[model samples]
Target: MKDSLIQSTDSAYSYPLLIKNLLQAPLVSAPDQEIVYRGDRRFSYREFAERVRRLASALTSLGVKAGDTVAVMDWDSHRYLECFFAVPMIGAVLHTINVRLSPEQILYTIDHAEDDVLLLNSEFLPILDQIRGRIDTVKDYVLLHDDGPVPDSHLTFSGEYESLLAAASTDYLFPDFDENTRATTFYTTGTTGFPKGVYFSHRQLVLHTLGVLAALSTPAVQGRLHRDDVYMPITPMFHVHAWGLPYIATTMGLKQVYPGRYMPDHLLELIDREKVTFSHCVPTILHMLLKSPLSRTIDLSRWKVIIGGAVMTRALCLEAMQLGIDLFTGYGMSETCPILTLAHLKPEMLDESPEVQADIRCKTGLPLPLVDLRVVSDGMENVSRDGRSTGEIVVRAPWLTQGYLKDHKNSEKLWEGGYLHTNDVATIDHQGYVKITDRTKDVIKVAGEWLSSLELEDILLHHPAVGEVAVIGQPDEKWGERPLALVVPKAGATAPVTEKAILLHMRGYADKGLISKQVVLLRVRFVEAIDKTSVGKINKVALREKYLA
Candidate 1:
């Protein structure tokens, strides 16, 4: 009997859900599909797989071993995609360093992750130079650049990226390991003290990829992602694995375009030149793309965009729809593998009026597959799903980070009551749709009444003249705080837009019982631009420091 059991165990293959397995389908189905970068360099999936193997060989040669963390600082590119697979395939953790962080913050993250190797683009060399001495954990550096010879730098390097790949073997065999092994790590772009590190395992990532793929692929006619769709991510690769969509795209073997460093006009050119179809970005990026003068020249009618990393306003959704572009909202955070819900319109609602559709498209959206999402009160009881009662958004998913890296206290707080706290105040309807009202910190209180800054911003965005807006809470003597609005008027707005006009627009909604009449205490200002976070989110922390402090 013991011999029979041992024979059965040896005969059955126990397949582990490692990051390397994501490439299997793509390799067979679309081996020749082109992965383009910057409308310049291009390679087929057949060659891309070779590059992944070569990269693994290179890293292994440079002393990278299982469990070592390999950090990379680069813009969106094919090389980064190779790093995405190769590092994790070899059982090493990939730390996607956010290059936008301050020099001091960057140093802190490197040390915190204990990164063993660094893959850096030449453009950000100056940043490393400023804090290189302080980055004690990194043992070797690999440089990446677009053209010309490598520039002279003081820091010693292992080798240039392309050179290393060219010299390495393309026949490296990747061994399988436990699925719970750490796969990736990166710090959050928090406005608080220090950016906290977050991590995911091989098992969590595989499940997240499958869950998101199922969600994107099942949408009937609205927001489906198929093998034929051309994938481009406007979201930074260093940001939460570019919301973990690259893995999905690769798994489906979709043609992908990676714009190196984002330039609005250049991005428009790439979309037009490459015939790109599906993409995702923060609201700021989408706004910038619309604002580009080249927007009028390009044919954007074929594009489908997923807006995330921030709340997308109704005005922006309307504008995109008017241009015949399909736009929707995706909701998640840096701690949750960065995707939870997508606001894909149901087929029945596709026949609705454009205005009504815009309202639906701008919602935070329904939770994705395997996402156990809830809005709960202080005691952890689920809130009523009447769409009017609001509470904190909590979630339990297969891929949520177990905890903040090295942060035990905050991790305990994040996972209190067996759910990850999102710190977002929101409501859910009977249809299981989540509509976020505001960040708990950003909510305004007046006369002992609560107000949602996001709701106020959404209302003001309906104004014809308001191009972009941010609402924040300002301290008040009579009330704890009142909402303040900073508006950016569109170039050549059809009608005159002023503080009074904006106030009247919001007040109309308040009078209709859509919002709190406490907005009567609201104030407005016209600013050239609003401050943004390192990852292009509206920097409420900076705004509060500048205006309210």
Candidate 2:
């Protein structure tokens, strides 16, 4: 009986077979459901599927051979969502470029991926003009806007998206390829250096989608999402394949909605008008939405938001809870098909107090099934689940990146000892909830002992006058390094701050032996505001470059 159970689990986890079955399922299952944009333009599942078919045919006709790379640069639009399926259906890998990247880095990724064709929004014409000569491998350019003329450039441009759709046969056949054939490739938003490319296979995408749905998340079980649920992922399709929700949403027959260009006001209007039930993005985006003026007028109580890409603080979680929105925190990276852990409460925690449940829901939740997650210190030794011992988190999963594209040195660093080593240092509780302390790279080793800059930053934020804080290690010959805090004060605060006062606050923490005694506040600089990633987490990489570079 035990053997049979193991075998059944293995069979159910197969990726290729699952994807094939999903693609073949009836399209009418998501009937009357819509993918909306700008509150007015939208497409039903019938029309959406037709567009995807047309896209597939267009790419194949443009000599997009199986295993070739197809790159996309656009906002979260219905057109970008179509490429999520169309490119892979023809066995070619889809590479979603981060439009937020610098022109030079964008060129590096396009050149590194050896993209065969590029699909871009006409809005990026200025940036494209700067790097047109650098990308030599791209054979065709497919422009994806209906209202504008193609931007003039020296490159070999082909046709507009609408024109291609008209020229190609929508009934062009989708060829069957091995499940392991690379389906998508995306560059990680590297904090320090040029972005690193990560690729995923069809099997991996299928498995991730199934696990995302089958998991005991509130939207899956509590929301009663059938084949008819409407999903509008506010997360950009270019980032980690929008955490793979675009594919899963469509395959599950869920009506999808995309907020074109991702204006917060537009997204809010779509949610209210389209009656969107499901969406996902980083915590900061939600923070903006909750604080945005539009949020006051829009109806948001019915939306189910999946927050990931960074840790969720108690304050942020409570704010969402107050709105009666079903917000759950998730954890993953670009390398692991990006779905490592979810903060959904376990069945055993169902009877626990609301506070206790909320704590678990804020930590990195239990690992998805088949994901072997562990926290280890210097060695591969597992840390105690007593919620105190924090260590580097590592994972082993089938869908992890093969390696950084063309960068073997970092790729090997990514998979040390046959496991994907996540630099995130964290602690797990008795119930298996993990809380991240800091990244291993971000940790400061003063006098050969660890000091958490995150902890220091968190404590500094408690100051009545401080609004935001970031702490980074600076070079020191004596202790090897020292910590410095960068703060952004709250608007219109009368209480002035100084380096001495900030360090005095730390003295109490240091005297109690909570922080390093060797820690010294070298300097303090007040800025207009701290910068952040597109997803809203503090951009420490930029800070390091500006201060420590």
Candidate 3:
């Protein structure tokens, strides 16, 4: 009830937090640290900075100006890293187009973002060829290719990416601007409608980088990312800035390796060849790595991975630990500048058994610095930190997306009560570690009891023959809804895993009172594969429509 505002002093210098400033520490301290692309190209941080400047100059030559939108559709490469800085540093908003989206969705986003210039990989040229004329706002294109002669394409390109950068001067100066100016934009992989645009400002990105750096630097021995650690991102760069780790990695000047497209054999090869110490990805990617034949031959003891974009099951955590890989869960959504919490262990908890540690690592984790996270009921009352009382997770942080671009109704709903609603149902323990039980929409109510589909999926994953599983609620005559699981079997399993075996597995947990007796109502179906979103999350929305509809 007091006036807490303070007036600015004339002599005090206000430093605006900008993306360009993040390069200062690394450039001064570790200029020679390397950034590698696949196994082919490598360059120092000093050269990386120079290339960023050159890229900005190239965009300028293409008539890119402050406030203009420059879009990119390419694989994860050194080129994408340059754009992460150069485009925003020069004051133009960078739009990281999700290449995995359907052609129509991609066209819709390109048009919706009003992209002025597009930099696309040659692999996606055919996709563009399919809908070239429908793309209204794009005036120019820059082609990105890895090796060999450039393939012929129908669309007119301004020039190739490296050629333009090579021809530009590295002497261009990046000017300072308002910290709150929009720096980047990308469309969210929304479930029901066309993807919604999420934009972040320069200030928000800077804050997010610092917050993530602090959280990952916590003194936990397992998953901490330090300057000496070699970095690779299993998450796609197009997805929430690969959960915003690239900036943190670049700021720290760590040795970075970019895998063009995620291939199991290649990723494992890179892990062994480059001695990759730290990386992050969705649960599906981790599963693929574990199932890869190369994973059996490689030494993964030195690797540390953070899993996000989906739940990290206990089975997956145990498998990684057995291979000496330090794996854990991180929690956030596209609306969050993506990292909100990390499942790192406390010093005292570090000595626990592997089973206990695996359970701890699979948790959603403790909130990062400057993040205000809470679980509240429908009435907006705070939920008890009892670990069993589930509620919606809501948070406020300097880096959270302000709102969906051009969507007033959903934006208001997202920011209701001044806290960004995560739409995830979770519980917090006395120790402040959060365990997400389910998405608000994914929680299944059976005969008046709430059953966590995530919980059931985790239990099913513990079965030896069950490779990957997704659980959804199906209408039942007796119970309001019953848990139905779609499962993918592990390759080369000695025995086939039937629905009866899966039910018996759940019944064992019910018999031991580990879960409710109603869990006996669970059903399972075998599937060839599970569907995934653009960012590698299990597409539960699509699954529900496929099986239950």
On a 0 to 1 TM-score scale, where does candidate 3 land against the true structure? 0.98
Q: What's the ranking of the predictions by TM-score, best on top? A: 3, 1, 2
User: Which candidate, 2 or 3, would have the higher TM-score against the true structure?
Assistant: 3
- Give lDDT per model, in order: 0.92, 0.78, 0.92
lDDT for 547 in candidate 3 is 97
Residue 185, model 3, lDDT: 97
Q: Each model's TM-score, in the order given?
A: 0.97, 0.88, 0.98
Candidate 2 residue-wise lDDT, 1-549, digit = tens: 456443466547443542434554547466456777656677877787788889888888889988899999988888888888788888888999989888998998899999999998888878888886778789998887746466676655688897888787778676566888888898988767788889888888888877776663343343234555568887788899898877777777776777777677777887887788888888768866876688877777777777888776655666676676767778899899888887775557657765665666677777887789999978889999999899989998877888988889999998998889999999998888888888887887778877777777766765667766787888878878777678887665788877777778778877898777766533567766777875567887788888887
Model 1 misses residue 326 by how many Å?
0.9
Which pairs clash in model 3?
Answer: none
Residues 34-150 of candidate 1: C-alpha lDDT, one tens digit per residue: 999999999999999999999999999999999999999999999999999999999999999999999999999999999999999999998988885787888999988898776
In model 1, the runs with Cα more than 4 Å from the true position are: 1-8, 494-496
Cα lDDT of model 3 by residue, 1-549, tens digit: 888897899998788999999999999999999999998899999999999999999999999999999999988999999999999999999999999999999999999999999999998988998896898999999999988877777889899888998999999999988999999999999778899999999999999999999989876586888889999999989999989999999999999999998899999999999999999998888888888889989899999899998899888899889999999889888889899999998888888999999989999999999999999999888899999998999999999999999999999999999999999999999999999999999999999999999999999988989888899999888899999999999877889999888889999999999988989888888899988888888899999999998
- For model 2, the local distance difference test gives 0.78
- Where is the poorest 10-residue window by lDDT in model 2? 216-225
